[model samples]
Target: MLSNILLITAVGLGSFRSVQSQSTPSICDNSTLLIDSRQVLTTAQECTAVAGDIVIQYASDYPATIEFPNLESIDGSFLSINFDEDIRVTRLSAPKLKSVTADVYISRWVNLTTINMPVLTTINRVRLNNLPSLTSANFLSTLESIENNYEVTNTSLKEITNDKLPFAVFVEIFDNKELEKFELKGLKNASYNVALRRNKPGVEVSLPALKEVFYFEFQRISSLEIPELERVIGHFVVNDSTVESLEAPKLQNVGLWYDPSISITNNRGLVIQNSGDSESLSFPVLEAVQLDLVIRNNSALRDISFPMLRRVTGNIGLEGTFESVRLPELDRVGGIFSLGNDEAGFNCGDLQAFKTNGTIRGEFSCPRYQELPTRSSSIGESEKEIKDWLNWASPSTGFESFRSMGAVAFAIGISTILLVL
Candidate 1:
């Protein structure tokens, strides 16, 4: 009887050991895990804690749903890439994921429609690219900071809400076709550059609270209005865009790097007027430009008025068909002053004074010579000669004189020569 009881006890102990051996294994056995398409994640215990990187490569045969409800932080990078032309992964949810110590890259997932990372707030860097079908990306609602760069390119991301990321070095958004508006209403500062280029037409960019930046480049945008931008430590360039109007009400200084600091060129539809309306382009508080201030090739531009512009440390080049050019408050220029196209004529006395006082560094051009004394004439005599010349060169017949002045300016390298009438 004792032998039979011992045998039964041993058998029961063996059964319990067998059950323990068949139970679910811990998924965190290794530091790194590479989940391929052939594997299946059936339970949450499959990924409890990853000490190292977690790379997920999607294939067509993989499960459509991927969720890690218990994952709170990744000690290493989190990378997801789908090479298959027909991606089967539709949803990825990591509800409790809060931080990633390294970079997070999600690229080439053509068919991925949704991504949910509700509590993710911090990461080292982020790159979201080449996801065409991804129209909505609200996964970064709580993202407050990034250590390095933040780049979003070639995606369908439309808008970014007011998220103040003060730790980022640079933010670049380009080649997004369907993006219509971008609101950085909460961003008050950045450490480096902010470049927005090649987006859809008529896109409105509002940076209401941006106070300073190292560099600011806005290319191929429709309209740019930065009401609170005060200073740029580097260059400020707006080129090849369809922006009809531009206003930076509080911009006080530009070109901390030096020459070619402020360039507004090739915007065919840009206009400058002083009508006290929103459509008119003006920089009321612009105090100085450290380098070149170029305004060229804007065909629709009619008038230019810089009321409070005080100084330019570099050259100033203006080449366009403008009806009127007014710089009533311009006090000094450190470099050359060159203007082409004889549409608006200027008084030679003003040009001579600016040149004589060492305010203009290089060649100055005056396309239309309105009135001037002869080589052997005095100042009083020149005044009478100018009046008589004005009678002949009336507004109706000014076109011929403009043509003549252009030819003469081209020949002599000076737009107008103070020749006797």
Candidate 2:
């Protein structure tokens, strides 16, 4: 068994060595006419279409800005080329380049200001090991430069801060751990179905056009502004930051608003703020929600109101707010709902007129009564008789007899019987 293991290990090492020997290390070149797309025209066994007459092969030290005049594809990989200087690709499509097998580099085309490479849909990997002077990934335009699956690592990048890269896909920026801020300004038009997590500091988190967010972790941010968010499709975690308030315009469920089985936990400093100026927030279709609504540590909060609220499937925490607790038009509550220890001492007897359904379970000892409109004695007696008849029709034996008596009384005193007992 030991000999067999050693043989397998030696074979594995040999294969790794063979692959390493074939791999070409990229070198830096400064003097070259950099292409506007930043792709190096090179040939390999992977090369599909070589130049017919001028067989100029690319080397590892090619400049980052060097452009190819007649090169069609790189090593049979899906390639996009921009021949014109119109700042947009005249012809951008990748038929031969199916997937990027290796990372291509543009050495140093000094005249090149911005690389417009939007025809690329997917790249296996990208390397920025020597781009010490590069300030932006401006080559990424629209959705073309983004791989269907992209990985950016090992660089001196200060920002993935593109306000406008429209590639709506998943990206993992691990290994480039020094990257601080990521801006989603260009992503405003994109419907990104993504999971962005575990980035280091200065990572600016802003998503105004996001509608559906799944398993998002903003663990290292000071402020998160997602104003246009409506639905959360998965678990949302906002922790270990100085976040003051969370506001969403049409936001209903953090994870399936109707599920009533999810929880919001470990967010000790999250504060919820109303977006509009005193305009009541509305959730018309929200049915049942299950989560710990922990609004305790937010001492600056004033009011917690769910006017048309239907049901809560978890613990509702209204512990550490200001004076008054008001939900004047609450319809129903499904689980244990409580008002935590308020500094104003729970002076909430004003909403009695709006309680439609649900068990009142807190220190509901304060019941503020409102005097209803009075009616004449005869009308009251008639209404009492009708109520007695309805109750008697219920499934209780004694009550049924009472209803029968009420019906007889109603028949006898159609005018002046003044039905009392």
lDDT by residue for model 1 over 148-222, one digit each (tens)?
877777777677554556546787878888888777666666668788878775567777778887667776667
Measured with C-alpha atoms, the lDDT of residue 143 in candidate 2 is: 31
lDDT, candidate 2, residue 367? 22
**Candidate with best lDDT:** 1
True-structure lDDT of candidate 1 = 0.60
Going through the candidates in the order shown, the clash numbers are 1, 28
On residues 166-228, what C-alpha lDDT tens digit does candidate 2 reach at each position?
Answer: 444444444344566655654432222343344454355676666654434454454566676
Error of 1 at 384 (Å): 48
lDDT of 2: 0.37
TM-score of 1: 0.71
TM-score of each: 0.71, 0.44
